[model samples]
Target chain A: DVKVTQSSRYLVKRTGEKVFLECVQDMDHENMFWYRQDPGLGLRLIYFSYDVKMKEKGDIPEGYSVSREKKERFSLILESASTNQTSMYLCASSRGTGASYTFGSGTRLTVV
Target chain B: TQLLEQSPQFLSIQEGENLTVYCNSSSVFSSLQWYRQEPGEGPVLLVTVVTGGEVKKLKRLTFQFGDARKDSSLHITAAQPGDTGLYLCAGDVTGANSKLTFGKGITLSVRP
Candidate 1:
């Protein structure tokens, strides 16, 4: 089975702290994405990478940055955590454009 | 407003009831995908619809893509407790990296 692994299930951080949410996929897919889920807001894309070291901003990337140092791993960084940033983060990977995404179990981050 | 819009933001039904949810857009899509997210977990891909007017079924669930390729629908028959979750619809805007959008998901609760 295809597997996408996220490093944390739950994280609590204080405002202004730097937070990193890690994700690793074993499917050898070329496209990876980071999305934050909030009630009523659904899942809003934060950042995505099409290849190693290639990152693009998504709909809600204003307060977030992403890293794709390797093909199998993508990282989402919250440079300065804020209460508004507290949400469930999801990581996904797909073979390419127009394909379905395989997602990790998600990391629920709480910025207090 | 989202590029894709899902109707009935929340649905609560009794077990064994039948329900249908919709995803719509004015812009065309290269492909549309449906995902289900349970509590504490990431969204999981349920199906993808690419061709216009295409219909696909997975056990008790049926998915259909509009002939214009601008909308989709998911129908669940004899809903069970196991069917409870947040249903999300996403589309690849012309199947590209910079334009894919996810709709505000519909939360379904199957009461026993």
Candidate 2:
């Protein structure tokens, strides 16, 4: 089956450390997104890319950045991980604008 | 930003019982999608509704979109343990970004 794969399922990082979360999709989709899911806050979009090397900030892009160096690979970066950054990070890819998405298994990050 | 609100954030029901989850939004959307997510996994797309007052079904699950395209609902018949998961609703806002706005999600637990 086609898939959007995340490199890690669980990650633990120390405060002030730089973190990288990678996502790869084999579906040859053009839209990729990064979202952080929290208990009460829900899924907040951090960044999204419509094409390779093109990135746009979402509603909650603060403290996060993204890189889409290749069409199949998208990476989310934390300049400096903080304790408050602990949450489940999800990566999704879609065929085009407003299309259904295929999501990764998600990376649960715990920052201490 | 467009927002989708899911009611009954948490629900617990016995197997074989039926339940319905609601998602409401003030802003009209071009389309709405429903997803089911199991623990440790990302949300999986179950159905997508585009036109106003549209209805779709998949097995024991039924989905309905509002007449104004501002709300949606998911009804599950004969709830099983497998149906227990987080149900999320997302709306596709019309704009250049073409990103979706997700709700906080409803957590359903079906006791066997």
Task: Give the number of the best model, judged by lDDT.
Answer: 2
Error of 2 at B14 (Å): 0.9
What candidate 1 gets wrong by more than 4 Å, as runs, is none
lDDT tens per residue, model 1, B1-112: 5789899899999999999999999989999999998999988989999999999999999999999999999999999999999999989888355435789899999999
**lDDT to native, each model:** 0.92, 0.93
Task: Give candidate 2 regions above 4 Å deviation.
Answer: none
Which 10 successive residues of model 2 chain B have the least lDDT summed? B93-102
The CAPRI classification for model 1 reads as medium
Question: What does candidate 2's lDDT look like per residue over A1-112, in tens digits?
Answer: 9999999999999999999999999999999999999987888889999999999999789899999999999999999999999999999999987898899999999999
Candidate no. 2 TM-score: 0.96
Q: How well is candidate 1 docked (DockQ)?
A: 0.71
Q: Which pairs of residues clash in candidate 2, taking residues 3 or more apart in a chain or in different chains?
A: none
